[model samples]
Target: MNLSRPLLLASNSPRRKELLAGLGLEFKIRVKEVNEDFPEHLKRAEVAEYLASHKADAYQHDLQNEILLTADTIVCLGERILNKPANYEEAFEMLSALSGTSHEVITGVCVLIKEQKAVFHDITKVFFKKLTKTEIDYYIRNFQPFDKAGAYGIQEWIGMIGIERIEGSYFNVVGLPVQKLYTQLKALGLIS
Candidate 1:
């Protein structure tokens, strides 16, 4: 991919940074403070897309022909949205709820180039083997995934052993859907 303008990533997530870098695209990181609060009526994918667009909108005033990227990931089981856990106990509870069940990992991405903007999302269905309390405790103690949505990282130890299978883009679970992002960038004429 080629770009005429510099790429700006407006997220603090290392996973997103790593995934984007893997595509061999050079970008500058610019963290923006935005409230992730969404309307109560939004569910699943809508929540992520809304938050991602909200993050991108923060840079609207300062954008200058730069391609800005922003994304949000959410884990959904049934109708419940499992956001980043605030505490260890919440982490344990969220994992326990996910044990031996299938959940959806939705990653919403927004690409902004001046006045042109595109918002899209990818959903990956992940199945976890029944996790033991000891395993969950060990993972929590060792990884301390408090900053990650769903209290877990798909590229971490827990994902290696706990996740039985996934039905969609694996990178989406990690944080960013690179394939989708690349396609979107090409469609937007930001890349070739």
Candidate 2:
């Protein structure tokens, strides 16, 4: 793929990097520390969008000829938003609540240049069959999903046995909605 500008990915997630690479675009990973905080009143998609845009904003002043890409993913179970777990207990609690239920995974993406900016979000509905405590414990202990939102990865073992179905893009649940992101980039004339 040929890009009109240098693509800079502002994230540390290997999943995001791998997903983007799947599109065959050459890019550079440039991660910076940004607080992932959002206003309490912001809803599911809004929260993800805000965080993605927030991360992009951190590079505003430093950007010269680079096109910055930032993304944030969140898992929402009704009104509650399940972020990355801090420890094993939180992971167990999150997976326990998700058992035999449906949840929305929203991933917000931001594409920014010195002159132009675009922010958007994609949502995927994931359904999980009933999961046992042993299953959750085993996943937590072995997979150590402390860095993943909702304490799980759709491509991991738990998803293999636990996910009943999904209503949207599987990649969205994994981390990035590559299709939507590709469309956005193409529309922006960033890639061809």
Candidate 2: where is the Cα deviation over 4 Å? none
| Best candidate, lDDT | 2
List the RMSD of every prediction in angstroms.
0.7, 0.6
In the range 141-162, model 1's lDDT, one tens digit per residue, is 9999999888999899999999
Error of 1 at 96 (Å): 0.3
Put down candidate 2 lDDT per residue, 1-192, tens digits, no spaces: 889989999998999999989989999999999998899999889999999999999999999999999999999999899999999999999999999999999999999999899999999999999999999999999999999999999999999999999999999998999999889989988886
Model 1 residue runs over 4 Å out of place are: none
Screening candidate 2 with a backbone cut-off below 3 angstroms (N, C-alpha, C), the clashing residue pairs are none
Among all windows of 10 consecutive residues in model 2, the one with the lowest summed lDDT is 183-192
